[model samples]
Target chain A: GAGVSQSPSNKVTEKGKDVELRCDPISGHTALYWYRQSLGQGLEFLIYFQGNSAPDKSGLPSDRFSAERTGGSVSTLTIQRTQQEDSAVYLCASSRRQGEQPQHFGDGTRLSIL
Target chain B: AQTVTQSQPEMSVQEAETVTLSCTYDTSENNYYLFWYKQPPSRQMILVIRQEAYKQQNATENRFSVNFQKAAKSFSLKISDSQLGDTAMYFCAFMKHAHNDYKLSFGAGTTVTVRA
Candidate 1:
């Protein structure tokens, strides 16, 4: 793809319902990351996947939040039994490599938990 | 743990003028990276500029430049010839330079309103 792509640009769901947000990173990119942006807050790091290495999941807020990246390309973030506080924008980003390369971000999926 | 701070919650700048957004970060690591990202109403975070901690010279991109003070742990962005399109939420971010550390610590963004 030309740039990072996220699916379901907007989602509205009832509390306790599970929601999945998807991200397709740029072609040949070796690293992917997930972040959450709440209203009036900064970007919160969620998880990261680099090549074939073990993903860093230390930033996941709770056990209900989980993510997976398949074949180091497409990634999915799942929230189980979502709460009202989970209503925010979920963003995904990718870089050519890890360290010094600037990350390119997706438009993000705005999840509204009603 | 690294932290980035943008004390100013909001700022207004007249079009064609210059405005500087302040940022400060706390990190024990000697080598790291600092970045400024712009998010418009569309919610896409676009990289505006970046500075490498090891470089003594600041980074610049056209009308966007940075004042990086390593000793003071400050990295501020200066937008020259501001345009209406520059009105957006600007974020300052910090990341370690280690190959295994890629997480970006971001600050509470500064809302920049470039008015005509």
Candidate 2:
């Protein structure tokens, strides 16, 4: 696509329900990243994927939060048993290669756990 | 662990005026990158400007420029001739230059409002 694309721009899910967020990175980009932005807070890194390498999941807040990138192009972030505290905006970004390159971001999915 | 800090939670400026947003980061790595991102009500984060740690000259993009003090670990953004379109939440971010490190550590963000 022309830029990074994210699905379900807004989601309102009940507590304990699972939600899936999708991201389609820019065409030919080799790096993808997931971040979470809470109300009035900074963006927290969730995960990173580079090419075919093993994803860096150290930033995931909990085991309930998981992400997977398929074919190094599209990615999905799954939240299991979502809690009210999980209400926030999930952002996805992609860079040309990785190092020294600026990341392009998608509009983001605003997940509201009610 | 690297950390970015933006002390100002909110700032206001009149249209066509200038405003400076403060940012400071703590990083042990010698080579890294600093960035400023703008998020409007639309929820999209747009990159405003960035500075390479090794460069002595600051980065600039038209009305947006940065004052990067590597020694002080400070990277402040200066918006000249602020427009209503510039009213947004501005974030400061830090990233190491290592080949395997690509995650961006962001500050709490500063909300800028340009009034008429």
TM-score of chain B of each: 0.98, 0.99
For model 2, the superposed segments whose C-alpha errors exceed 4 Å read: none
Per candidate, native contacts kept equal 0.95, 0.93
- Write the residue-wise lDDT of candidate 1 on A52-76 in tens digits: 9999999999999999999889999
lDDT of 2 by residue, A20-104 (tens): 9999999999999999999999999999999999999989999999999998899999999999999999999999887646799
Where does candidate 2 clash, by residue pair?
none
Specify the poorest-scoring 10-residue window by lDDT in model 1 chain B. B95-104
Candidate DockQ scores, in order: 0.92, 0.90
Tell me, what's the RMSD of every candidate?
0.8, 0.9
TM-score of 1: 0.98
Clash counts per candidate, in order, are 0, 0
Q: How accurate locally is residue B26 in candidate 1, as Cα lDDT from 0 to 100?
A: 95
